[model samples]
Target chain A: MTQTFEIAVIGATGTVGETLVQILEELAFPVGTLYLLAGSNSAGASVPFRGKNVRVREVDEFDFSKAQLAFFAAGPAVTLGFAPRATAAGCAVIDLSGALPAEQAPPVVPEANAHVLEGLQKPFQVSSPSPSATNLAVVLAPLRGLVDIQRVSVTANLAVSALGREAVSELARQTAELLNVRPLEPAFFDRQMAFNLLAQVGKPDAKGHTDLEKRLIHELRAVLDTPALKVSATCVQAPVFFGDSLTVSLQLAAPVDLAAVNRALEAAPGIELVEEGDYPTAVGDAVGQDVVYAGRIRAGVDDPAELNMWLTSDNVRKGAALNAVQLAQLLIKRLV
Target chain B: MTQTFEIAVIGATGTVGETLVQILEELAFPVGTLYLLAGSNSAGASVPFRGKNVRVREVDEFDFSKAQLAFFAAGPAVTLGFAPRATAAGCAVIDLSGALPAEQAPPVVPEANAHVLEGLQKPFQVSSPSPSATNLAVVLAPLRGLVDIQRVSVTANLAVSALGREAVSELARQTAELLNVRPLEPAFFDRQMAFNLLAQVGKPDAKGHTDLEKRLIHELRAVLDTPALKVSATCVQAPVFFGDSLTVSLQLAAPVDLAAVNRALEAAPGIELVEEGDYPTAVGDAVGQDVVYAGRIRAGVDDPAELNMWLTSDNVRKGAALNAVQLAQLLIKRLV
Candidate 1:
């Protein structure tokens, strides 16, 4: 007889959470019972799964012992609040938030660092890195030995959907108002978001680095297992709604071989390398895709040691929900 | 007596050309006869100068000798076709198009290298660098002495207006169609550009570097007079109507002092350095502005030798038209 485990999805009504539930259904991950949980404000909302509406219950009142595994798809505070309880009940926790310390819950991108999972013990805890880090890791993992990467500089054009459904709706409203020639009153965003790009994604610290930017640097280094790698990151909030577009430039220790790099990228899993002379964009190519689309690959104009690329992927899907689900798939094997 | 020279603006009906004419009036540049010339399609159009509308004549028929100076704001082909005639007619040439070789028409950002203008002979020809190059030259000129720069990486978020009026109108139309739930049929742009960012601004060469990207690298090196400087440039076509946003990361030879860097930027001309907490956006802060708006300045997360910054400016006004006009302001002295 086949056996299946019951699972709980925290923050199930949120954008990434709902997508997580949908991905679970799409991937058919041997689910027996699904519990959708959210905070008090969203507890009554219903998320659809397998053509049925699953009403969300409050995370505060739920008992963690009922489920063998739980996915925390909410903010850092929510993960910090309920993660311990779930782990204490012997539930394996997969955190989508960058809340737990790297020592406690090592960030894992299955395509890059799947072997890290073998190191964890019972009542396992693993973290899915931030959207930018996850997408970059998937693309960069293949080039680990192909080039001696010395420094990496990335400019991430993030979508509004990364913020939440409210930010997504705000973009639509702002665009409509501006198109109709109505006076724009910015709400969800501090400034006009339609037809514009916001340089800073979040509040910067004293050193003028936003949490998102620092997160990309830290998580990328952790997943790549290169602690001393020099990374420069800029997370800009684009007018886009769904996917994240990244412009990446890498400084290598020696002149690179373009033919070998292309061959490696083509053979790598979890990435779709578009043919040369054609590039991918977030809305058209990456919005509903499962793999990260990479194109415009070339060495620098004059410096052969420099390499540049354009990458796009679904931030909520491949970057977050799908990554968490992939980790869960690996965990299910050892759970029983 | 105040002496004014006759000036002709080729491609006067273009976005940059129109703005150049307007700046000539606003900055009170000495203009004797302002002859507006464009291609046959735009020849019959009229553009406002001072209080009256000036009729644009056909460039093919306009006599180059009729003006002492000519501003070639059209495409490189048009500049290549008519600039030699203007020079032969003893007309001082200011080419906004990157058609002429750097040796013949040296790229100049007045704030960075106005000294290049002093070496010119009669019927002088000077090229106004690309918007991205011009903006970067202005910001980097002040930092030349402050840091020992080794390499530069840039991701330029360009507006559709850089492609002129048709591209701008397409963005508006694509946006409205998407907002109204109507089927989108992309016209000027090859893809859905409403809420999407096109990774490539123009067709890339065999090496995957577009002409615009190469122009930026070449022009920046010339303007800063750093011929061997290493630069990695990625120019993305954003959905914005105006203003270009650039994310820059510089690798320095040694550790940087943040306080000293801030002081240099604060004292720099042609730039507005926003405070630490508040940042600038293209639509909210840079559109229709003369100076580049810079914010989110910091070092790398762990590397002190790396400096990153965000910059936004009116691509047509401050980047092209105003810079050209500023050059002409200095040229009027030598013209007479």
Candidate 2:
């Protein structure tokens, strides 16, 4: 028998949240009913789900008691406040934000670590991976099968506007002004977002790592189940509007061939291998796509232990919304 | 009595060649006489130099008989054929291509390795440093005084249109056409040079490194005089029309602070530091400028040895024409 699930989409108006609604419609997921939840400011607005307008209710007032699943795209504060309540209501929470209390939550990439969510008796919480995690996970999938990862270093040229819708608008407006067209005043970002790249992403942690970078390293380890792995990241914001690109260098525990690496990626789901001479997938190419586009894979000429590749993904979709929806779909498949 | 130099500029109507004429005029070089040489197709054209319309002479017909210095900005083939003839004519040959026979040529970056060219009893043959070397030499000047180098990994997102005027025009036309503005057929590059980033630059070496990447690696070693140092580069073409941006990750020999890096770069000539907040220098900012703009400098939280920085420069000026002219100025001051 076909199963239908009731779902709550928290932060329904956000970039990721909006994408979640769109993907649900596109995939034709068996949705019996949908709830749209957001903060006080966004409450009362409506987003379309299954061809019907669903009004967004404040998170505090939302009834999670009847929902079988909840997708949290809101910030940590909202996720922290509402996720436990929803879980208490017996709803599985798929969180896109990294703010979930780690002890109770498990970070997941559906393809890489979907099994981690299969046996949870209690209402389980799964997080949508960060842009970096979304990038590294797909590339790592091929490598993990071949050799153990000794160390991984990634430098990200993250697009500044990937922060949110406001950031994206701010960049578009500022770019117009910078080129003597029209002024887009700075409000969403702390500084000028036009024609410039920023090095800072998430708030700085006590140890100086950006919160996003730290989370990516942590999430990578957690999802891969390699506790002893060494991971370091230097994330910088680029002027692009949508996609995030990373130059990843990995040191493996054993030697691996480039052809084998390509084979692994070819077999992986939701990954499109971009070959040399193909355009390096940019923000525009990834803006509405769910798949991770990867290219420029090269084994180091001097060292077999070293491998390099470029990973590009739509920060809003694969990095957040689609992953959340995918997790929800997996939960439904595993549960009654 | 002042010694006068008769100079001939091969490829005189091209971007670098035009800039060379302008710079020579601006620097007031002692030009006893000047000859402009171009391909047979451009033989009848005239380019303005020092307020005079200098008729372009066929490169094949040009006699270097009276010239004391010859600047070859033509392609490798022309340099391979004509540079030797100029040298045989008792002229000091400054080749931009570096494809000149190794036995007769020594690579030179005026600021970093000009001393190598001093007091040559035989007419010296020097080739311009690669764009990457020209950039690294200027930025490394400050770093050398601050920290010892261990290794560097660089990914060059080079704009191939930086190759020449024809490529630039082709790219602009193609971009416009791609956006449905007008038809701009491909001419200079092998494919449509619009809205795309190509990965190959120059010819690929047997091991698959691009000619420019190979030259940069070798030229950097020669200019820095660091034979044992390790370097790896991935060069890719971007849709940009002018500047080149390098995302550099360095493993320093000693621990260094980000502040020290900022201060060092600030004090360094030909480099503008854009470190604070989200202010990253863009290709537009560096276009038509001489300075290499360094920004978004950050330290790796997990690994102190790893530091990330972004560098952008006008490939035509600082990367090519301006640098060659600077070498000429240095030669005039120290040798002539």
Candidate 3:
């Protein structure tokens, strides 16, 4: 049975939010009515949905009384301010931001922990894992089912497009200008973004973990339900436009068969298995894709307990927008 | 007193070869004469050495007898055919390919194992450590002095520029064309090189290790002198034009102070300690630089036995050319 939903997409003009509208329509989500909410700057701007243009209204002026679900694609500050108001008005909030604390709000990846969202009576918030974690989880899910994950080490090459629309534009403009031989300047980023890779993302905590790195550590533990699992991550920004790639190493408690592990990944949901010879999945290849493309799975030659793999995904889509919409679908199906 | 000698730079038109010429002039390596040798296509190409233009001569036409030290920056195939002839003719061959089997050659990283190059009876072939190994060695050198390394897990984000000039150009051209831009094609690589990261280098061996990865493991073991120590690595290409970055997690046999480790890194040779907040060393910043920029050195919160760090360097410089030149300098000093 298909039920119609009057959905309000908060932060509708942003990268992930824009993607949310497109993906929701593409997947044929039962949207009886669509409300596009954005900041004052983007208010009244129209976006295409289901082959029609929907006008974006200012969030401050929008009424959520009729919204069956409010998808918060806005930043933490806006989500914090408006989420409670939307929830109190009898609208279920599915937030993509990590504004709420992890323990109180259930962080979810549809493929990993969608079941947690099934019994929510109060307003539900869905926090998509950071890009690195999202890619890691997709690759690690099948491996964990086959091996006891004792340790995980990852190095991420993130794209500027993951920083949202402005940064993406900045990278593109700067790259074009630089190629045409112009003076390069750093704008959206603290340093020059074109033709370079930056290793740090987000502010570093006192414990020495960058915000992105910390999120990956905490979120992975929460999603995998392995609080004591040891993880080490290094996040780097590359010169690509939209997709992010990660090289991951896992230390298993027991020996795992490479063939079985490979087969499991191939059969998993939202995953595309690339053969051994195919790897370093490029940003252009993953830009519009929803599935996590993975390849170069190999067992450590000298160490039988270790396995290596590479994963790539469109950060704005599967890592954020698609993931949020998938969570909402799970909610609608009562599967989460 | 500095010894001046006529030097021949084989593969003079290649990436590392260009850097070799630049660094020799920058470091004031006493060059009485410079001979630029390359393939027939590059025969008329000119490279600047010591403030003068030196036209490239075909490898077959170069007079080896006039040169005292020949820097072989060419690929393995060229070195295999030419190096023996040069060495047999009484020229000191500094081979960068590192393809000579262990039984016949000695791998050298001046900072880690320079002693092997001293007092050579025959023409000594000084090989730079593979990019992955060289990077790992730079970070590990400081730590090894403080703790016993149990094992290491590394994921290298190797830039396409590391493949040499042709690959870099091809990547740039393909990337532009893929975006609906005009043809920027440069025929230096096997595939469309733009906006893509290729994970394969040096081809894969029978046992599934890339020739580059396998060589890195073997060279690292040999340089560290821990034949039994376990090391695992995954090398991936990033879209950046220069600079290779690595995320490393090392297991120590005994706990060590993170502060003390950072201090050691600051004092280490060929290493520049990047500030904690400064990471993701961009290609522009790392390019034309000789130092291995090390940053984000931290201990894993979940595991005290492990340490994580980000290391970046210009692959053409520190990873290949500069290291080769440094090896020659060390040999002259009798420190090798």
Candidate 4:
């Protein structure tokens, strides 16, 4: 007999949430019944599932006990408000927001730290890290044995789409306004977002580090299970719309063999290592892709012990939705 | 009496060359006569100088001995072919192209290595470092006194105009095609460069490092006078039409004081330090500006021995043309 579980997806109208629903359909997960829920403002929207329109209902009115699993894909406040209700109703929760503390819902990227799930109890809670951290974890997990990484410095060139649907539209609007030679009246972003790069993404704390950068550093360390690791991160808001491009440099304790690094990446799951001399770009290769594309892999120009590479991935799909769904697949096996 | 020199501008029709001509006018450089020279293809084109349109002539037919100083802003091949001729004619040379060897034309960033000019002989020759290196050198030169740096990692987000005027037009055309939903047939770039980031700028060598990256590392080391310093550089071509943004991380020998770092940056010439919280961008702050904008200065999240900063500058002016002009200003004092 085939056993299937009922599922609920919160924030179904969001960019990542919509992609999550689509990926659930594409992966053909054993979903007995799918419930799409959103806030009151978006309650009437309908999302397609199994070639049929599944109307979104208000989460305030939906009975959480009816669904065996719930995915929180909204902002931190929304997750903070509704996540407890779903967990109290004996439903497992997978949070895309970083609202829950690591000890309460340990961040998980299956490729890097699936073992963190073995000790979970019923009504399980887990977190999918930020796009930058998840993408890095997937690519770095395979290299754990090849090199002794002492420090990591990453510059994450983020896409505007990660902000939301509004940001995507704003980039288009700004680009159009510039191309047409119209005076730009900035709206979504505070300044010019077309053909420009913003050094900081969100507002920084008193320490001069944005929330996104702090989250990446903390989440990457946690997922890689190297809590004492030193990570220097900078998150820049690029003019890009859909994918993230990251340049990473690592300090190794000993000289690393380039050929061995290539072989490891080639054999790793959830990663596509580009061939030598050719590199990957967000639009040409990584958009809508399931795996993180790693390229330009080489040691430092003069220092043999240093490693540098470029990584690009579909932020909404592989970085967020797909990672959460992969966690769900693993969580279901132990769901009692 | 105001001393004036006869100046020859090679590649006068190029983006940098045209900008150099304008900057010379803005700075009110003493000039007896301005001679514009370009390749045979670009000859007959005119560039405006000091409220007059000066016609460009072919470099092959021009007499180098007629000018007291020559500025080479063309490609390396062009400089390699004509720089020797200019020097042989006893004309002091300032080359923007990285063609001449360091021993002959040492790389110079006026803010970092103005002292290198004091050692020069007659018919002085100097090379302006690449944009990434010049930008980094200007920002880091002020910090050499505050911190004992161990290693540096940089991710340079370069603008399209750095390649030339044709690359700028290609970016605009490709962007319009993408926005209009038309099928894109990439002409200037090998792939879709609109709303995308190319991981590598130029062709990489057998060791997987591109010429641009190597040039940045080499030129930066030379200008900083830190030959043993290890630098990891990744040059990514961005969608921006002008201005270059760089994210730099430095490993220090000991804990760094954030206040001292800020004070040092504030006092440095050729650099504008933004307010602590408010950051700078390439287009909003750096484009068409004479000074490099430095912002988001902070120590590492957990490691006090690490320093991180963001820098953006006008690649054509402050990075290349203005730096070259500044070198010429210094070199002419010793020209006999």
**Tens digit of per-residue lDDT, candidate 3, span B1-336:** 766877899999998899899999988987778899998888999998766899999998876878878888888898898888777777778887876775466667777777677645556566677766776776676566688888788877778777777677776667667655685554665554565555666566554568777777888888777788777887776667888888878888766588898889988898888777656474645676878888888888667778888888888888888888887787555422
Task: Give model 4 RMSD, 1 decimal.
Answer: 1.0
How do the residues A1-336 of candidate 3 rate in per-residue lDDT, one tens digit apiece? 767888999999998899999999999988889999999999989999977999999999878887878888888888898888887787778777777777656678878877778756665656777767777777777666688988888877787776788887888877777777788887888777776777777677775687777788888888887889888887777777778888788888876688999899988898988877656465535768888988778878677778887788888998888888887887766521
Better of 2 and 4 by lDDT: 4
Could you give the interface RMSD of each candidate, to one decimal? 0.6, 4.4, 2.2, 0.6
Candidate 4 interface RMSD after superposing interface residues: 0.6
Sorted by lDDT (best first), the order is 1, 4, 3, 2
- Considering DockQ, where higher is better, how would the candidates rank from best to worst? 1, 4, 3, 2
Candidate 4 local lDDT, A1-336, one digit each (tens): 667989999999999999999999999888999999999999999999999999999999989999999999988998999999999999999999888989989999999999999988888999999999999999999999889999999999999989999999999999999999999989999999999999888899998899899999999999999999999999999999999999999999999899999999999999999997899988899999999999999999989999999999999999999999999999999874
Q: Kindly report which residue pairs in candidate 3 clash with one another.
A: A117-A336, A118-A336, A198-B280, A199-B279, A199-B280, B115-B336, B171-B193, B175-B194
Top DockQ model: 1
> In angstroms, how far off is A9's CA in candidate 3?
1.4
Positional deviation of A284 in candidate 3, in angstroms?
Answer: 4.7
Query: Considering summed lDDT, which 10 consecutive residues are worst modelled in model 1 chain A?
Result: A1-10
lDDT of 2 at B329: 65
Docking class of 3: medium
Question: What do the candidate models score in CA lDDT, each in turn?
Answer: 0.94, 0.74, 0.78, 0.93
Candidate no. 1 TM-score:
0.99
Q: After superposition, how far is residue A216 of candidate 1 from its true place, in Å?
A: 0.8
- What are the per-model DockQ values? 0.93, 0.23, 0.55, 0.92
